[model samples]
Target: MHHDVPLIATVAMAFVLAFAFGFLANRLRLPPLVGYLVAGVMAGPFSPGFVADAALSAQLAEMGVILLMFGVGLHFSAGDLMAVRWVAIPGAVGQILVATLMGVGLAMAWGWSLGAGVVFGLSLSVASTVVLLRALEERNALATPNGRIAVGWLIVEDLAMVLTLVLLPAFAELLGGHADGHGTATGGGLLWSILLTLGKVAAFVALAVMLGPKLVPWLLRQVARTGSRELFTLSVLAVALGIAYGSATIFGVSFALGAFFAGVVLSESDFSHRAAADSLPLQDAFAILFFVSVGMLFDPFVLVEQPLKVLAVLLVITLGKSLAAFAIVQLLGYPVGTALTVSASLAQIGEFSFILAGLGLSMGLLPEEGQDLILAGALLSITLNSVCFMGADWLRERGRARFPAWFDEFGKDRQLGLQGQLDELRRKSQAREEARSLQITSLIERFPIFADLDQAGREDLLMLFRPRTAQPGERIIRVGDRPDAAYFITSGTVLVRVSGQDIRLGPGEFFGEMALLSGRRRTADVTALDYCQFQTLEQRDFRQFVSHHPELRQKLLELVRQRTEMNRQAAAAQAEPVPALPAQG
Candidate 1:
């Protein structure tokens, strides 16, 4: 029974091999990513046995890139980037230039064309987002000052690559590669292409920064109100994927860049934490596919065919790029520890390198061997990236002990200043989280009706509540007045006057729902007995929430019925007051 299910076959083989190799890698104390890559190699066309569909794997890997970048953007705020801009901007640029120069020099010695050399050098200049994020996350340094700097540096490199990708085609004919006829090799056309690409990128950024925060949050809240976990998760994924896809299609930017901005926009919303939590599993799984897909691209024959060339490319990626980053950071007045961390974080090239090399090959700018060398270098460097971090840690410790002055004297003040800013940012983030937690806790404790809500449900309820306060003797509701909202008393007391009877209610009690449910004017007068706090759910919001949660709606209906009976009894007793008084006498 044969079926046309290449995608399923690819995904299954990829996962199975990844798990097996990943398990073995863990047992051997290596990064599981190393094992994942090895698995991909085994399932690749170059290896024996089954060959997974490379195209499907690549597409899946693209999704992984999109989601991984989105996840990173959720945590990385503009404030964090600005905090380390002084070091990140110049350091990243300077390091790229240095690394590129080194690559160009090496390529020159091999008598390659200038275009090939430039493409090769540019490919080696950038680091892998997936690898760096994983390394930082594993060490719990993603939110650290150094980590922010490294991430910020990577962002700069990504932006540069985006521009390079745009300009490369425009300059193809000029640089000895056949142009695809979209752009001219003339200087004016090159300038125009550059300006156009920059404009598109800027427009996309502006739109995301200006409109995305407003729109995405509102959409999320709307979906959240539906009380569907799957829908909310779907919505989050939709927003991520949609924005990524839209930005790329409309703005001519990379999908990774687009997804990143989508995340940054959503990060400003109150639901950011929940969104991040909900989307994490998918992001991680897809990110694993990214590693596997990368592995599938490796032509291991390059290792045997051009050993020295492969080694040279690996050196440029690992040693050359790292040393340049280290020197640039130190020169930019960052501490040795920071320099080491940033350096190690960037010791491997990834997605962009593959993209550039592929483009180069398509344009006939780079030879096949160049592409193979880049792939081999990527594979080897990624595998050894963990060791690079370990080495950096060891070197930092040794340096601290042997040359304490280097750590103490170099960039100490600047490092402290950056640390202070990072701490402030972290404190603000923590405070917001605590405030949200306290809100949920208070709601569950004070309101039994809300006790059954899960975290997402509680968060949705919180969003609907419009907080209110009333002073003593203030009439919150008047007899025969139209109901606008239902009030839940968080604190203080209120008196509900029905007929001649006064019913007192304290914290956790609520009023104003009877009129809302019955679709009539208020039948009772409610006044604050003392200073009061309330969470008022407006009629529209109340109906929407209640509709989504039928159980809660039923509970409210029951309360309304009970209140109606109590009112009737009170009125009847008031009417029979004369006979009651006579009997008492």
Candidate 2:
């Protein structure tokens, strides 16, 4: 039967499955990349209902990988790359070589052919940019030192991987005894292929650059003038896909590479973020499916059969690449923390692994096992790369902890000289909430309770004021309940009922301070009957704060004393009868 399933049904099914797994992964806090991979495994040939058309799925995945690479290129500007190149270049290359060598050595030891060994080694050496990028974003580390280096490393790896994809077929064929190292006219043929590919690449870049700057910007300007979002979206897609198709058809280069260059060129224009915001969501969906397709290639049975080979590859992926990257970054004059962290983050096989494997299969450089191995490595690499990256942070802290004593006096002491400059920037970033906290603490410290504290006590108090959210109808304080914390509303409102009388408070009004100051039960019942947010100072923090600020304590004591005196005055006034005046009829 040559009948085919509708594209919508197939793609829809894949998406539904991807969503289900993604949701599950989210619930578990596991990476959604793992979810997509698991989705593929569940929907694959080895599973119950095999619905994937390998060729169709693979073609879609190819498009996805291309777009993903393009996305990477788009986010990373040349300036961004240059800033972190020192760490990225050596870290990425070092990890790749070490992992590759480890993979090849393991294969040889396990009696696998040399060609397969090389392919496996190379494949396992790269990490998943998709996973790493998402993880970095989640951790708010994307703009941090490690994130920049990580992105740079992956960009370099992609370039290297693409080059290897171009060269691997010939290398493998030579090693596999399928062809002479040099063929008759091989020199001419090879040179011609190289020149043609390069010429097309150069031509595409030059043409796109020329056309993109003038044409794209002009078109975008017109679109902006008209203010049609739909048209703008269509135009962006057209630009991306049109450039992609033209490059692929004319030069025989991967559409993915073309899209990447297109993004880079577009980056020079003003519409970059706007386009990215609109288009990246689309890219993310397809790219996830692309990962799922890679999972479709994984056969656990094969790995089980070749368990030794798999384990060996895993070792190379983890240990070999880590060491390789560390050595390279250290050699490049980076601090040990940056060197190790950057190295660990980049140590794994990635998107280009599948790209190379597919190219190799088409060119006869790799057999079925080689392709499968690459696929497995890609999935596992994504899973573990993030783990290694997390370890990199820990390793960084350790490196600083072990920072040389004199490095502080000569190297780091100089950084301390800029403490004022950094402080200025930090103050700006601290925003209003942080500024408020600082102001309040400074005021509190002027009181008797906190006046005696040293610098460290102030630092400890600063850690207690993270923003908190409250649900409608949630009680901030229940009258007569032991108050373990003090609530100061930063925004939103709360209803206070003291002795069955009601009062309302809005921003900057504080409650439970009496309890906090006196270590007593809440005097009022306060409830948030609407969406609200607030900050609470914990009991321990309150006590510590009071202890440190003696003046503040003395002031609070005086206020409490006044409150008691007022209660007595009220009682005495009540005891005295009110004088009544007679009115004339």
Candidates' C-alpha lDDT: 0.86, 0.68
Model 1 backbone overlap count: 0
TM-score of each: 0.88, 0.66
How many residue pairs clash in all the candidates, one count each? Answer: 0, 22
lDDT of candidate 2 at residue 14, scale 0 to 100: 81
RMSD to the true structure for each prediction, in A, is 3.6, 17.1
lDDT of each residue in 1-585, candidate 2, tens digit only? 754665665577788888999889878767777788888887778778856777778878977876786677667567656656655676677777877787788768767677777776777777767766777787797766556667778888877776675455445544562423454335667566567667767777788777777887777655543334567777777777777778789876667777777787777565776678767877888798787787777776767787666665666666777777777765665556555556666655667777766665665555777677666665666667667777877866665577664223332332343333434544554664477567657535433344455544544344445467778899877878997876666668888776445678776666677887877777778888677766667776666566656766686678767755764675576678878989989
Consecutive 10-residue window with the lowest summed lDDT within model 2: 406-415
TM-score of candidate 1 against the unseen true structure = 0.88
CA shift at 10, candidate 1, in angstroms? 1.9
Give me the runs in candidate 2 sitting further than 4 Å from their true place. Answer: 1-4, 110-118, 166-185, 398-585
